[model samples]
Every structure is written in structure tokens, then in C-alpha cells.
Target: MRRIPLFVLGVAAVAAAAVLIAPGDDEYPANVVLPSATGLIPGSKVLVNGFDAGQVDEVSIKDGRAQVTMRLTNDFAPLHAGASARIVWKAVLGERQLDVRDGPETNPVIPAGGTLDGKASDPVEMDKVLAALDPATRTHLSSLVQGLDHTVVGNETDLRQTLRQAGPAMEALGGVLRAVGSDGPAIRELVGQLNSMVTTLVNRDQQVRAIVSGLSGATEAVVQQRDQLRAALAKLPGTLGTADRMLADVPGTVDKAVPLLEDLRPATDRLPAVARTLRPVLADLRPTVAQLRPTLGALGTLLQFTPGLLDSAHGALPGTESAVTSLTPALSFLRPYTPEVVGWLSNWGSSAANYDSNGHYMRVNIPAGISSFDNNPGVMPPGMVSDPFPAPGAIAGQPWTDAFGSGVR
Candidate 1:
């Protein structure tokens, strides 16, 4: 103010130059070819992953396609190859925007002015949707709306109550859904098993039908005897009481049998070995048992007459005893002469055995003094010098019968 400083003026000049030369923002241009550009226009917002990062600079029709130019800030610029775009509703008021998506980082970045083929997903207009419906469909939709309006218009209170109650119902349904989801695999397996069971039942339909028919016949038979069945049923309580009383003792009996079973444990343990041993023995005995059949038959035949034989023997026993008693003395008397009788018989056989062309003849030696004709006197035959028959002790100096004592012999 007093006198403008040159240094301040120079400083202001540098600040002005810096503001004019400094870069504002880095923007990349991109083109999108869309099938339609219904709500898209210049100044429409562009979004990348739901974040505003650019705006549509222009929209024009070219070769039957809507060619849109986008100006994107550097933060979202130079989208990689394979980038895509789609026009979507920004709000319920028919406002539209372009939704962009970046491709994989591994792809090269798209250069400025590169084109992307936008997905033809124009915002849906309710009027167009209604207009596209066929007459029949529209009629059905009108009928449904009328039915709903009739159901709900006058019953607003009840509908509100139902809606309020529906909260718990929906919560319960959600819990059920969660539970079902948790056991999905198990439920699926159960369903598969049920399917298999159904298949099996189908396969065995004839047998199952036969069984059902038999059961039906049995049921009819039972029904025919309903009177008797009723009588039995009338007695059933008493019978059941008796059975209950009887069965009450069963536990006691079982308790008593436990020790017996325990006592028999050792024998039971050895039973397998016993059975193994008996197997071969029983096999070997089978032939022997077969052989004994005839003998047993003969014995059976013999036994049939055994009582008569026993009776006859019983009657003859007394007489046989008496005869044996009668023979006892004679047998005793002959017992002492047994050796002499045996010797005489042997000597007589030898003497009578002589044979010479004729029949057998006895050889005898006649003593000189033993002529049978003269019994009056002691006679000597011719050529006899001495007595051929000596006195009892003359020839042997011993008595002739000294061996025979004064005893019973």
C-alpha cells in the first residue's frame, strides 16, 4: 500500500504460473458398444463395482448400435482387457447408469479409446413388460389381481393380524429350513434308502399281494369266529392274571438257574471237545450198529421161546439131582480100581492085536503045570523040570498082591 514490493509481485506471479501449469486429473477415454441406450445419456453416472468413477460423455447411434463414450478418472481408468459394461437403474425413478467391471489383473490394461462390448441388459420398464404379455396372460393376471383385491380390500384388519402373526410363523419356518439344511446329506441318504425300499416292494409285488390276500382270508376266518373270540377275550383278563402270576415266578426261577448255569460252565466249555470226540466214534459205531441188527433179531427170536425152556429145565432139575445122588456110591466104588482097569484093558488090546495073514489072534503063554484036563493032582507036563507057576513069593521074593493093602483097594 505504501509502495508495492517487487518481491511480493514476483511471488504472486510464480503462484499464478504454478496454478496454470499444474495437472488437474488424469482421465482415460473408453467406448462402449451397446445394443440399446434407452435411459443412457450424456452426464449419466458410470460406476465401477458400485462406486462412482466416471460419467458418460456422449451417447450416439452408429450402425444400429448405441455407441457410448465414457470419461473415467485415473483411479478407474485403463481397465484391463476383457472389461465389460452394462446399463442399470440407478434408482426407482427411471434414472439409469453404466455399471463397469474390470477384468482379471493378469490381463493387459486396455488402452485409452479401447472398446468394450457392453452386455445388453437395459433397465426393465414395467410398461414394456405389461405390453409384452399376451392377451390370455393379461386376462389371467387381471383375474389374479381382482381375486387378491377382493380377498384383501375389506379384510384389512384380519390381513394385518395375519401379517403380524406371520412373523413367528416365518421364524419357525426359517428354523425348520436351517435344521433341514444342517441334515441335508442324512435326509438325502434316507430318501435314497426309502426309494430303494419302494423299488424292492415293487419288485416283490406278487408276493406281497399274496401275503395280503392270505391275511385278508385269515381276518375273515377270525371274524367268522367272533363269538368264540369274544368269549376268549372275556376270559383273557383272568388268563392274563394267571399268566402274570406264573411269570412272576419265572424271574425267581431264572435267578436260581443262574448258579446252576455257572456251575455247569466247565462242562459246557468241554462240550465242544466231547462232541468232536463223539463224532468219529458215532461214525465208526454206525456200521457196528448195522451189523448187530441181525444178531439182535436172532436173539429176539431166541428170547421168544426162552420162558418155555426155562420152565422145562425147572421141572427136570429135581429128578436130575436124584439120579446124580443115586450114582454117587457106584462112582465112588469104581474110583479105586480105575488104574488097574486101565492097565488090564491096555494089555488085553496088545495081546489080541497079533495078526499073520489071517484075522487078529491072541498069543498066550501056557504054564507047564497048568493043564486043564487034570484037576485031581498037581501035574507036570512033559519036558518040565520045575514048576512054571511059583508060589506067591517064590519068583519075585515079594507077595503077589502086596500092592493091594488092607485098605478099601
Candidate 2:
């Protein structure tokens, strides 16, 4: 009242106006404290019941941690004491909110002084997360998007390739679809054809059965002859062996028969010549026998005389006993001089044969064949000429038929 300053008078008026216009304390705004949550700046909205309860009003350091104070309108004050609150999405745009769920009917209410049990939410901040993204991460995301766009763009090409790879199958499917498209005619015709074929087969069934029955009968017949077949098969080996032996003999038989077969033609051609030569010889024999027949009649009387000659022919051979006895005495006497006699006889023959006609002594050289000669003259062929000149009277000493007969004997 006594001369107060103008600034002090205005501050007092503003304080009185704030107290009078403010909502009443008993009608209280909600207290939403970030008692456990730290790093929350002032003016951050506090959520309750999935809606904005209030904003962070003040922040201060209490004990070792930051304590945040918040104010809620009286509208959400009840939610603070009676319900649970959690962060929730407001919209797809850059906004967020909290959602509250009331407890079950029997659940006790949350005390105002107690903690809300909130934790730090892992939220994607549109503004902050976008701002924090570096060039590389943004580039990677861009590339991913571009790749997706490219994949979408190439979908037609990929689809065409797949279709091409599946061409035959797709064509089959198309044919099946076309077949299905025909209402009934195609199917009916196919069915009719099938029916006809089945009918034809059915009609021929009896013939087929008959053929099978005939084969069965043949098989039964073969089975009935099993023992006979076995016996025949067992004998086959012996038969084959005989055949092989015959085959083996064929070559030897052919060798012997071949020369006879070759001579057959020539022999046939000479048959008349052979007969003529034989005929003359036989005719001569017959005539000679006829001429001898008269002589033979006379020879009949001579035949009686011929008996004496025939009887003398019996004595023609020397008596074995007397001749053997004579030979012993003669051979004994001749044995000592046998070698000297032989030598003298050989020299005499040589001397007589070697002399020429004039009696002038002629020398004869031994022939080349003398090497094959031996002292044993018994081994030599009778009358084999060993001298260059004939021995004197050598041929005259023997009868014409006696090659070694000596006239002296």
C-alpha cells in the first residue's frame, strides 16, 4: 500500500490469478512418475490406459539415479491406481501410445506410490531410426528393394521358362482339357469303340480257350512220356559216339577207295584188250594139250615107266644119314687146308682171268667196288663177277642152270 514498485505489483496480481484459475488440488491431475525409467527427457508424454495420461513435468537427480516427475489429467488418474499400462502403437504414422488393461475382478488395485514395472521398449523410431541410418545400411536396404523390384519385373520371363520346360506335360494337360471340353460325343465314340473291341475279344474267347486246351493236352502228352523221353535222351550219347567213330573212319576209307575209283574208267576201256590176250593163251594151251593127247596115250605105257623115274626121283635127294657122315670126314680133312685152298683158288682164278689173249702177262687193277668185299666168300652172290677179265673156263665149268657148279666136282 505505501508506494510499492510496479513490477512487484504485477507479479502479485499474476500469482493471485494463477491460484484462482488453476484446477483444484482435490480434483487432482494424475502423477505419472518415471521412477524406475531413466534418460527420459521432460515433456515426454506419459501413457496410461493406451492413451496419453500426461507429460513429463520435471526431472531431478535423486540418490544416484534420475527421477522424473509427470502430470496426468484427472481423466486418467483412476487408471494409474487401478490398471496396468504398457506402450502400444497408435498408428502406422509417426505416433505411439500406451494401452492399459484392467486387472481381473479380484485383483488388487495398483498403489499410486508403487512402480508401474515399465521396461525400455525396443521401438522403431521413424524419425530417429531414419536419421541414424548410415549410407551403407541405407544402400543395402535400397539394394534389397531394387532386387525385389527386379525379381518382380523378371516374373514373366521366369514363368515363360517354366512353361517351356513343362511343354509336353502342359500339352498333355491341354489335350485332357480339350477332351473334357467335348460334351459327350468323343467320349461316347471312344466308349463304343472300346465296347466293340471288348465284344470281339469276348466272342473269340472260346477259340483262345480251345488253343490253350490243346497246348495243355500236348503238354500232358509230353509229361506222360517222361520216362521214354529220358531213355531216348540217355541213349543219344552212345549213338553220337558211334556216329563219331564212323566219321573218323571216313577218311581212311576214302583214301583206299579213291585210287580204285580213278582206275575204273581206264580199266573199263581195256576190258576187250585183256580178254583178247587171255583168249590166245588159252587156245594155245588147248591145242598143245590135244597134240600131247596121242603122246599121252603112248605116255600111259610110259606112265608105268614114269613111275620108275618118279620112283628114282625119290632117291634124287641125298640120304641125310650117309651124306652127313661123309660130310663130317670130308670137312675134317678139308678144314686145315680150307683157307690155303681158298687162297690158291682165288689166285688161280685171278691169274687166268687177267691174262690177255696173246698170253702176254697183263696187269689188272682192283675195281672200285672191292672195298665192299670181305674175306668171307660165302656172303658173296653166286656168279657175281669180281674180275676185270673173265676167268678161263669159268663158265664152261658149270651146267647152264648151275651158277656155281664146278666141272671138277
Candidate 3:
């Protein structure tokens, strides 16, 4: 009796377990037919507007199409016509779900026991993408992959070193990019100018081609002369260093020159007026200068003789001084009688007017003897010693009495 009871208990436990694990036979309100079920199964969740509505009940291939029968609960009932159903991956290469997008909200729900045909849009296969590449591109891609594999195979340490070294450079590059981005308008303007320049170059394409060809030739020539170039490059550092040292003193020189520049400013300011005034003077002088060409030509000869003339003048300068000194005493002795001599000449001028057709002659008479007043001269003309004596030539061999008879009377 206890064995029978144990058997019955075992049967009851089995029945309960079977009822829990069995598939449900609940009737679905609507269904949809799909073109393909490449990644879907019967137990896949059916989604309406991205929410799980129900589960797929059966999946079978009929007439080259996948007839996916969905068992939607009452909440997902009345699946409207014109609704679209597709099996979408929940995650990349992950489990698929049935997505149903209903048509217009006003569209009538699909009738029960009716089929809704849906289009399945599958993800592109990797093979198809690979097959689409051209031969050259494929070759390049293959080479790139092989090179990467080779680089990674045994160069892990080197790769790590390279990445470490690149960190600072990448940081610096980021900083530069950030700085450039901060000046957005300036960068845009630069880009615009570059675009204009490119357009100009494009417009002059033939010229650009010629320039490129010339540059190519020049590059070849430079390559041929690389040894000389290298020698020059070797010397360039020292040259640059010397130049830098020389330039170091320039600021001091410039500071020293500041005062001079400040002083020159006033002069420079007046230069325009000076230049204006000089213009007419220079124009007028042009002809005079032209006329002076001969004179100027002789100037060189004049200059050549000037030394000799100067030497002669220097030699005679002492003699001239001596002669001038000697004349001083004679000039002093004659100084008192100068007035008498002047008076005699004034009185005798009226008396000495006689002339003949044969020749000119002076009319004059000589007194025979000295008068008492001759010791002291008077300013009057008739006084003794006032009149000048007759010239010796006029009195020669002639008696004074006869010559001066009229004057003595």
C-alpha cells in the first residue's frame, strides 16, 4: 500500500512538470507572412513599435517564402493592414526580433484569419562587401592587412614604445587643434583664402603644370648637386650662429640710434619745404651750370697752377711788407706841405693853359729871387712860397728876369 502511494505521488509530480513545460495552444488574433526567416525562430519575440507584443508561434517555408505565424496576445490584437514586419537584430549579430510597424492610426485592423505579407530587410553579408571592392583596392587592402599582421606578430614591445612616444605628440596636436578651433572665424577666413587660391591655380592649370614640370626638373638638378648642397648645409649652422651673435648687438645699436632718429625728425619734417624752395633755384641754375662747363673745365688747370702762384705770393710777401714800412717816413715828411702843394696846383691850373698847334705846352713864369715870406708859407695863393716854382725844363737856359718879368712887375 505504501509503494502504491509512492507511485501515485511520482505520477502526480510528473504530470505537474509536463503541464508546466508544454507549449501553450492559445489562439493568436493576427499573423504576418515574411519573405525570409534567415535569422528568426519560432520562439522569437514579436515587437510592435519597439515593444514586445507577443511571440512567433510557427515558422515554415512555403512556395519559396517564409510563412511566419505570430501569436499576438489581446493587447497586440487588431494588427492593421499596410503594417510592415521585419526581423531585426536586437544587437549586432545578436538575437533577432520581429518588428511590426503599423500603418496610419486610422487604418482598420487586419481581419482575423487573414495573412499580412512583410518584407525582410537583412543586413549586408561580409562576403558581398568584400566582393564589391575593385581588384586594385582589394590588393591594397590585403597588403595593408598583411603588413598589420606582420607588424603586430612579434613587435608588441616596439608597438608599445611607439604608442608611448606618440602620447605627447598626440597631446600637442590636440592642443594645437584646440587653439586653432578657438579662432573659428580666422580659420574660416584662412580656409576661404586657400579656396580662392586653389581656384586661381585651377584657372591657370596650364601655367601650374608648367611650373610643376619646372619644379620637377629643378628637383632633379638639386638631387644631382646634393653633395654640394650637403656641404653648404654643413656650413650653414656656423653661419647661422655667427649671424645670430651679430644680431644680438642690434637692439643695443638701435637704442643708441634712437636719439639720432629723434633729432633727425625735425630736419626731415622741413625737408619737403626745403626741397620745394630748392627746385626753382636748381632749375634756374641748370643753364648757368651748363654755361659754366668751360669755366669748370679750366678750373682743374687753375687749381694746378694755384700752388705755384701761392708759393710766389708767399715769397714776395716779406718784400712787400718791407717796402710799405720804408714809405712811412717819407709819407710823414711830406704830410705838412701837402696842403701848400695842393693850393699851388689849384692856382697854377688857370695860368698853365697855353697850347700850340705844333704841340701842347704849359704857360708859366719863374720869380728871380726869394721873398721874405718864403720862410713861412701862407694859405693865400699870392703869398711867397705859396705858388709852385717853374718846372726845370721850362726855365732851362732862360734868364729868370726875362721869363718872370711880367710876374715880378
Instruction: Give the TM-scores of the predictions, in the order they appear.
Output: 0.31, 0.22, 0.32
Please provide, for model 3 over 88-184, each residue's C-alpha lDDT reduced to its tens digit, 9 standing for 90 to 100: 8755554677888777768875655568768878766656777999999999999999999987998899999999999999989877865785577
Write the number of the candidate with greater TM-score, choosing between 1 and 3: 3
Ranking by TM-score: 3, 1, 2
lDDT of 1 by residue, 1-409 (tens): 6356877888899877544333245577889999998888899999875567999999999998999999888787668888899988766667899988889879987867789989766567877887999999999999999999988988999999999999999879877875786678899999999999999999999999999999999999999999999999999999999999999999999999999999999999999999999999999999999999999999999999999999999999999999989999887766555665676798899999888888899987766535566673665667644555433343345434432354334
**Compared with the true structure, what per-residue lDDT tens digits does model 2 show for residues 1-409?**
5557877899999877555333455222333333344335566666653344576666666664444555556665433334544444444453544344445546554433334433335555566775789989989978999998888785988878888999999779866764574446778899999999999988999988999999999999999999999999999999999999999999999999999989897988898999999998998899888898899799789777987897786786568667878799677545544555676788768776755667746455666653465775545465555544333334445222222244122
Ranking by lDDT: 1, 3, 2
Query: lDDT per prediction?
Result: 0.83, 0.62, 0.76
Query: Best-fitting candidate, measured by TM-score?
Result: 3
lDDT of 1: 0.83
